[model samples]
Target: MTPAQTTRRHVLVAIALVWALVCGGLGWATRSAIQLDSFEAREDQRRTDEVRMERALARMEAEIAPVLYPERARPYMHFRSYYIATEARYRSDSSDASRDILVASPLKDYRGPDWILLHFQVSETEGWSSPQLSSEARFALPAGGIPAPVRPREAAPENWFAALQERYTAPMLEQVLMETLIHSGEVEGLSAAGPRPDAAPDAESGVRTAAAESARRAERLLQMQREIHPASTCEPELVAMENLEAGSGQVLYNRETGACVQVYAPLMTPVWLDLTQDGEPMLALVRSASVETSKNCTLQGVLIDWPKLARELTEQVRDIFPEVRLKPLLPSEMAASATVRGRLHTIPAKLVAARSPPVETWGLSSGLIGGLAVAWGATLLALVAITYGATKYLTLAERRMQFVAAVTHELRTPLTSFQLYSDLLAEMPQESAEKRRHYAGILRAEAARLARLVENVLSYSRVEETAPNLRLAPTDPSNILEAAAAATAEPCQKAGKELVIENHCPRETRIETDSQFVVQILTNLVENACKYSADASDRRIWLSAAPGPGGSITFEVDDAGFGVAPKDRRAIFEPFRRGTSEQGRRAGGVGLGLSLSRYWAQSLGGVLQLKRSSRNGAHYSCFSLTLPSAPRQC
Candidate 1:
């Protein structure tokens, strides 16, 4: 190569290196960005899921507010009443003569949430009493200490304290309540008669002193004026306290002094009583918060079915967290369940997502992640495009250098013949006409060789400049084959080979292509066949035209030359590339012959290819030209 060409090649190499480096950096950055974006997206989705879980649990807590603090639903559970009223109503709407009556109570009917198993109450010197017994039956008991209302208040309680027998069979609720009083230490000292399961305390008659005794036990804790004492009849003229709604615990207050006395905590046990249900499950008991007495408790609160209720709560949060768990707090976990307010003893259970929350692959920032991935794809494609362009430019340059060397070698033989024949013709006698005709023939053959070489060189240059100049016209396929036989006839004769044409085209079939290109393409193929197969025993070059696939005309040039080596097949049609066989080495034409033919064929909208085939188990390469067949009428 020239020094200038070498310098140009070095510059191209440097440019390619710089481009590759820049592209590599771009690729790595794109990959990193995509990875980082995916990580951030997953993190964002995880946080969103966590927030969703918290909100769902908060909504659940608000929904089950009444269950957590039952006193909030029935404030009388905190008031000082044995059979506390859940609801109250006035006997008459008339302001003058109106007495308040309890419309609902635990002892009246099991009107609490279904989650609660049962409700029962125990009074001082009185055992357990459920709503299972009618008011008449309860009042008819032998130790009945219940005040039988006289005169105006002596009204039928037929509609009050209806039997709750349907909820619990006889003795089942009664038996559980009796056991509760014993276990809770309430009946031992708080109840004067304790639990009399068979008789039930105050069943028929006894110390109408039960109310007095209960008041005394708790009176010392809340020392106050007689007018404000619970045992004293409530007079509206005395204090200005309003009945609070069920959302807040009921309280007895002296609005005059702004004092709140006996909140809801006293009427219901603040902690679970026999909640674990290790043995005979006990009833819920209410120990007055006003009176700090151990065995000095008063009444029982409602019992709840913990396991079933917990499962239901867990079910509600399953969508947020598939493995969510809602469970009663064990003694050890109870400390954690109670928040900073120092254990108000409302709910002692916990709800939690049992497993780590998962972030879906297709999540919150999926669009961003997808965009980053597209950037990575773009970077890789750009690198591939740059690399391909650089490689193609370098390959074309190498083929040009090879073309220059091959052409120099091609010009050597013809130039030497012209020199030898010119010197002989100048010195030969004027009378030797036979010698002059022979010399003239030899000169014409050599001139023909140079013309063919120049034609190929010019054709290749024209293809490089732009598209080929084509004159399209309808021409018979057989005519093209005959032209190729004539053009390559002299070359074949000199090489001791016969140029044969076989026409297999049906009549009326023609090609719609440039006839000149077709003939020149076939001529190049036949000349290659003669040069490559010069030593073949058959000494024949076959040129044929036939009907090809897809309604096209095919022209094939087949030879028994040395088959192309496996390695050379790929580059055989590449500009300036030649086979490594001994026959190809001896052939002296620039390698642009087949390349130019393919270019021209393609310009005429046809394909030129070396069709691999074996004739009678002997390998022979066939160069085939397939062109579009013209439309013709029968």
Candidate 2:
């Protein structure tokens, strides 16, 4: 290899290495940048989730205000008085007259939520009174003749209250109100599941706590109720509710003051004093007057049914946050205000959520990722193509340099022989005919060798530079074969090989081409066949013309010398790339005969191919040249 060619190859190798590094670095950087973008998106999404959660919680706080306070419905629980009449004739004495007399306050028509188990009013004047029961308090007739409120039979046998009394079941709420106003007992058994059984310090305590704590719950109401309730997130010392549902309704007002019933009755139960003291987690609102009126010890409140209230509240906030909870705060929990959101001012409950912080993604998509991968691969492919093309062209340049050197040496040998023969003929005596004739014959052989070499050199140069000058005409395939035979006849005779032509084409078959170009192309092929097959034992060359593939005429030359090696099949068609076979390597004219012939074939708008070789058979190389039958411009 030449120094310049070796240097060019090294440069190409360095360029390939550089391209590989550059492409690899670009791919790595792209991947890292995408991962960073995704991380930033995740942080952005978490911030967004926090803001949305705050707005939803604020709405829940506003909506729940009325239900918790409900101070507007306070008037419905107030008490009033009425009168009763006694008939003299119906009395045991059987008297004649009937008279009206003042009596105790009657029970009002109490219509309120069942969750509000009981309502009571405490005062110094008449002690405790409720609209659910009639009062027996007596007063002297007023100076303004105000009507009296006779006690009603609210605890009549048919009423639920009477059944409780008949069964001797102690009231859950009334006893608590009369004894311990607000204490730990109320908070004892409120569970998200159900009220736990209280250890009976005794039987009386059990009966009182059972009605308040062990009430049944409707859990199959909604799946939301099943999902998030007060119990799941913020469990309290008192209650833990799941799916803390809520409901809303218009308050019913029925103030039948001064109303009466068939009889006056109130529950007078066996007094059992509650011994437990007031504990840390009790909720109450007690108000007193500074200017003190006749009703002094005023304490009015309702003992709420917690299970029913939990359902109402959890349902209310499900839209705002599906996983919300309503949990009662312990005294310690209430004091620590830093961790609390949506804590109720009206009650000891607060709201909590049972979900995690979220991530956001905007710039990262599957399409973006896929596009980057494809682009990276495409760039690498383009680099490989450019590198391969550079290497191929470099190798071609090296082969061209070798061919030039080889041709210079070959031309010198023939020119020196021709000069030597001419000198010998001139120096011989006129009488010695045999010696003179022998020298003359040597001169002719040298002239022919020089001429063929010169012709090939000139023809190759002209063909490479531009299209050949043509004289276009109609010619028969047989006529082209005959002319090629005539041109290569001397070479075959000198090599002791017979040139044979097999013409299968019809007489009428014609080719519209430059006949001169076709003859030169065939002359090159026949000469090349004779030169390479010189060493073969069979000194015969076959030149055949036949109809070829794609409606073109084929002129093939078959030889039985050392055929082209499999490795040289493709390289032999390229300029200066000769076959490596022993016979081919020894006999060659700059490797341009077959190359120039193939060029001529293509310039005539046809194909030239090595259709058969020793690789496909026992031992023959067949070079096939096919020309177009159709007319074409010169």
Pick the TM-score winner: 2
Query: RMSD in angstroms, all models?
Result: 13.0, 15.9
What's the distance in Å from true for residue 629, model 1? 7.3
lDDT of 2: 0.55
Question: In model 1, which runs have C-alpha deviations exceeding 4 angstroms?
Answer: 1-269, 272-325, 330-345, 352-373, 413-448, 466-486, 501-519, 544-556, 563-571, 602-609, 612-618, 624-634
lDDT of 1 by residue, 514-615 (tens): 787788888888878888877778776778888988889888888877667768876888888878899898886778887888877777778888766554
lDDT of 1: 0.56
Clashes of 2: 22
